[model samples]
Target: MNTLSSYKHDYGPLPSEVSSAIKPIYEELSKEELLERCAGGFTQNNTESLNQLIWKITSKILPAGSKIVEIAAFVAAGTFNEGVLDLLLFMHGMDLMLARNSHEYA
Candidate 1:
């Protein structure tokens, strides 16, 4: 049986008021727009790694403004999408030079 059917079987039918409260939410979730939004499904692996990378770029212990956070996110995204070498090259193109020793790590 479906999950909703199983739930009803185990716990009896939802009260009219409870069902009414849930109906709109269920309807909205089942709609094409929401379904399309959910089509990609959920995965936290990449996001967690990217967040770690961002925090590494801009330390979590320090207070940062939105612009700093934004820059860190962009840098993290570039590093994640490309590699350190490419990110360094891109920064070079934009006239942002890394220290001579830092290039060795890349």
Candidate 2:
């Protein structure tokens, strides 16, 4: 498995601005606030936002070289379940493609 140091080299460190912004938001957050932010959706709803948030958070935690399937498997290790993992992998793939397309035009 790749180390965190290697991952940082591949993706570049989080920008200082991003780190600064996120730090205060993270620090001031209660457990519920944190969960809500991470969960990413209308309150009391399970929707595409949840999946999108899962992808976003996983992208941060996962090594740059890690496959979406591998990340999905890791996420599925707990209460997330295999079916949900598969869906997440698919969503991650879609997000990656969208990102790539956007970058190509920029």
Best by TM-score: 1
lDDT of 1: 0.82
lDDT digits (tens) for residues 1-106 of candidate 2: 5884365455647897898889777777756756777676545444454565456546566565567645644554422444343554555666754455543433
Off by over 4 Å in 2: 1-12, 31-106
TM-score of 1: 0.48
Pull out the clashing pairs in model 2: none
TM-scores of the models, in the order given: 0.48, 0.20
User: Model 1, 21-104: lDDT tens per residue?
Assistant: 998999887889867776797535788999999989996788999999998898899899887876777678789868987688
Give the C-alpha lDDT of model 2. Answer: 0.56
Report the Cα lDDT for residue 3, model 1: 81
Q: Largest lDDT belongs to which candidate?
A: 1
